[model samples]
Target: MSKRREIETLEIEKIVEKLCLKSNIILRADVLRALKKVCKNETKNPVAKKMLQLLVDNAKIAEKEKIAICQDTGLVTVFIEMGDKVIIRGGNIVDAVNKGVKEAYQKGYFRKSIVIDPIYRVNTGTNTPCIVHLDVVKGNKCKIIVMPKGFGSENKGRISMMNPTSSIETIEQFCVETVKIAGPDACPPYVIGIGLGGTMDFAALLSKRALLRPINLYNSSKHIAKMEKSLEKKINDLKIGIMGLGGISTVLGVNIETASTHIAGLPVAVSISCHALRSASAEI
Candidate 1:
């Protein structure tokens, strides 16, 4: 028989802190590659080419200075993978994760963007109460990923309780409409994430989770992968380009994630990220 593994809450918090700092400072490799790819593809559009290169350059400076790639710094989002055989000590998982975020913000001196109340509009100060999602899978180790999700592209997200009878083109059109609406405001050379199942809230959550996937990869489903490629082409064809400047490359990549849901309900959500798609992960 296999023995259960014990994981200290302190260990989780420390790793979370390090990941928060690291992700905010460093641009993910896949995102960087996409930016460079667009630089090459947008040779005809001088403005687009220059803007895309600037983004790549900005990433380099942020890494060297050990500062946030984007000033918004974003509301912290944590995704945790807890192994079924593991047990935690010291404190609860959610509290530990939030503690790590608080420590990281203090240590790194990142911006405090979170507000306790939507209407009151008071700063949380500590950047506590970050978004956390935990999952139990078959394993013995806990894995954590921290993503600093800026509100720029996040606000551009859209959701629809798609009719169960909707066609593929209908879904594709909704995703395209979202990008056109986002335009330059959300920042361009964007990474588009789509979630295609589950309930209203879950679909939105899945959409954000979809953004965590590397832009270079495709979903496991054959048809889904095809749809991603199709949706990407459709979005770029809009010529929203880099920051709505008009170029061959509008979106860097499109990723779609799906989950099972009730037969009577069909839901879809779209999430997006700017060129500075910042995230980092650690396994313990």
Candidate 2:
């Protein structure tokens, strides 16, 4: 028989509060590395190289000063992998997570961007009611990842329900078109997340999940991996450059996540994340 562990909700809240601040202030390691790598070897284009260097420097200053990497601060989204053998005590998990976010935004002096209603356009003020996705797993430990997603790139995401028989070129076109449409507004030198083979909503969620993957990692399946590389090549070829100044390094990477789907439906979602690509994870 396996041993079960009891954890306090306060512990979860504290961990999440720390993660919220960390994610907002510190750029992900992989993202920072990619920026430096490209900036070092990037083409002779003066504008592109200068922009990439500024981005790299900005990341450094933010972490050193313990300040927000971007003014948006972002909408907090938490993804949790909870073990079934674990028991929660003291309080409800959802409330605990919200309290954590509220505390972080207030303490970190991060901007609160969530609104009470889309129509009313009033700020929630607490950045509470953060979006949470939880999955029950096998172990006793709970893994949590906090992603501060900025709306500039979020608004540019696109989803399409296409024929299952859609050709590779067709799919590539849809994905590439999204980046092209985003232009400079969504922030270039972006990380592109492509989700394929699921229902409409799941596909969109998968795209967001794809952004969580490290920049250099490729999909495991060989065919899928090839497609990812091809798409990455195609996007950089757009020469959107850094902030769309026109250079060879438009995107840092492209990630594709897939799920089993019904035969008639081929749902595809494209999510574009800007250079910051902030996320932090910890297990408890």
Candidate 3:
């Protein structure tokens, strides 16, 4: 039998806590830089151009003050890639993740956005539990990524089951239309993540995961790459601008990931991410 390497659950918990605190409470440097670049690229509209600059300035202020970029911090989400050879010795994986979330939110002075109960709606004092997705892969090390999803863009995501006969153009149309309708509500200069195939729920999950891909990389398949580029151009053409005032910096990137699907339907999902795009990953 392969020896199971012991994993320290406390370390995992501590890491998660830090991730939670940093993700929402801090304006990540990468995302901040991206916004500045997009801002500098706009030349046509004065309002949008000014909004972009203001966003940059605001980010600077948040950094200096060590404050959250947005009031709606977000719900905690952790994605874990567990090693097959690892054995968690201290506690349950989910418990460790939850404890980490609680400590991080509390220590970082972030607002607890989680409500304990539905209908009655009581706030969970600390963001005790995160929405965790775990995958056990063939490896001896573990990787964790935490993403705090803001309500604005999360609310705008959509899923659809189209006839399997639906053409690629149809898929593109749905993506573009969804963003168009989202307008400024979902926030502009957004990252659009599209997941096609699988069942409806799986498609939505994949779309969310696709948002984790780096902004600079294009799809691997040439055909898919071209489609992504075309869709990106269309989204930018909407001229939603920095904060939807109208400019050339609306959509920063479009990403699509897929899996084989059933024969009768085309399962599609779109996840919209706002300008902040706060996320971070770590390996141990």
Query: What is the alpha-carbon lDDT for the whole of candidate 3?
Result: 0.85
Lowest summed-lDDT stretch of 10 residues in model 2? Answer: 241-250
Flag regions of model 1 displaced more than 4 Å.
none
Best-to-worst order by lDDT is: 2, 1, 3
- C-alpha lDDT of residue 244 in model 3: 71
- Report clashes for each candidate as comma-separated counts: 0, 0, 1
lDDT of each: 0.90, 0.92, 0.85
lDDT of 3 by residue, 129-239 (tens): 578899998877889999888889999999999999998899999999999889988778898889999999989988988888877678898887888899999999998
Top lDDT prediction, candidate number:
2
**What lDDT, from 0 to 1, does candidate 1 have?**
0.90
Better of 2 and 3 by TM-score: 2
lDDT of 1 by residue, 1-284 (tens): 34699999999999999999999998899999988888977778998888888998999999999998998889888999999989999889999999999999998889999999999989989888899989998878899989888999889999999888999999999999999889889988889889999999999988888888999999999999999999989998999887688987778899999999888878999988887888899999
lDDT of 3 at 33: 73
lDDT score for candidate 2 against the true structure: 0.92
Error of 1 at 281 (Å): 1.0
Candidate 3 lDDT at 125 equals 86
Error of 2 at 101 (Å): 0.8
